[model samples]
Target: VFALVFAVSCENSNVKEEPKKEEFRPLIVRKDGQYIEYYPGHKQIKMKGREDADGNRAGIWKLFSQDGVELSITVYTKGKKDGHIVVRYPNGMPNYVGEYVMDERVGEWKFYAETGELLETIVYDEPTKENK
Candidate 1:
């Protein structure tokens, strides 16, 4: 009887356990005529912006860090980057500011130090058709 009980316990110990499933929730929603997306578990907002009728990113979009801090602001037209873009450090200081034309960087781009001082500026020339 002791041998039989020992064998049963060993068999049970060898049994495989199923993996746990991760929880996921929908992120996108429509609020006040705008479409917004939230982070998993609804802990914080991930992005808020407008989407075209075809569900493409349009107008201005703001993305946030996992901690709910604004990370970047970008303007999109038909899912393509256009207009001005600003990216910030995790500490909420501006890291860079630049403009885009049809997904191509244009004009002058400004970089900032962590102290919010201007670091450097770069000028981007228009791309030629051959190089584009």
Candidate 2:
């Protein structure tokens, strides 16, 4: 009957709509080799990660700038950074090279001059200590 059909449609309409899922955020390559989202993005941005068959980040990741420049190339192992991580200047010269442990600077770091010369070396024996 029309009444039965109307009642059924009304009940269906009363069903709650599913909540929208949160957008995928970019993974922050931590020194512990874990990929966690450290920041949020507004648009659909491409991301890269070293993933195992289980789809967890297990190695290096290279994140690109929205303009397609290599923004940062980071290392990871079992989701932790354990090796050289390099970031470049817009012109592609070395911006930073250093070691990390659990996302903290824990070793020697060298900076290069814009002219491509070694600028300085900083040795970190402790997170709060620096020897230049």
Candidate 3:
């Protein structure tokens, strides 16, 4: 988990604020550790993940709604999505679950209904004769 430390400042807000101009949102700032993004004008974590020293995504990243419901989860390797990802409905039901290899979807992917019934299955990568 990323410990909130520094206050992020918007890169575009370096100039003096003009009364007529719209305010800019803060930019994400990090220092070779977990990254946590807060909701605009709020303190709740909108997204959180860890990154390598060079800024490459290193592990699982999770996104949440403003009220703290998990929206989706994805695993990354060197900034590329390389594992399972599950996206959920607003009510927190799993909408779809699939796997990724090197940022590409692979194997069987399943979609479900809000009632928790399987709706469909799609094979992203068919088995080859050698693998069969």
Candidate 4:
């Protein structure tokens, strides 16, 4: 009964709201070549550490091709790639997905073709005498 009443009240509420949009605050560069490529057709692209008001890069950053196909999706923790980074083919199909440690491949990395077929798997392991 309370739920029904609350639902009706919510439907009649006159609250104007805006959908949350991803924010892209440009980083100020003191040196040359320090800007993230946030759009497609961006040649000679370079990226610098993005920061928040408190100076943190805890946001989503993407790269694209000239045809507007998403090339990569990388998330940063304190300005380093500390999460899943996805790379796609120019045709927009997934090319690779894996874990990264400070932008270095650290775990299982899977590669796929433009048609979504598995292409390969890469595992990082130190060379052992027996395996060598």
- C-alpha lDDT of residue 1 in model 4: 100
What local lDDT score does residue 14 receive in model 2, on the 0 to 100 scale?
92
lDDT of 3 by residue, 10-127 (tens): 4445667657965675646465598888887755789889998788887999999998999999999998888899999878999999888877778888999987789999897653
lDDT of each residue in 12-126, candidate 1, tens digit only: 9999999989776678888554887888788899989998887777899999999988999999998888889999998899999999887888888999998899999988888
Error of 4 at 12 (Å): 59
The predicted structure with the larger TM-score, 3 or 4, is 3
- TM-score, model 4 to reference: 0.50
Per-residue lDDT for 26-128 in model 2, tens only?
4454334334333345342335665665556567787665555676778766566766788777667787788877566777888886566888998989863
What TM-score fits each model? 0.69, 0.50, 0.70, 0.50
Q: For this target, which candidate reaches the highest lDDT against the unseen true structure?
A: 1
TM accuracy, model 1: 0.69
Prediction RMSDs, each to the true structure: 7.2, 8.9, 14.9, 15.2
Instruction: List the candidate 3 regions with Cα displacement exceeding 4 Å.
Output: 1-27, 126-132
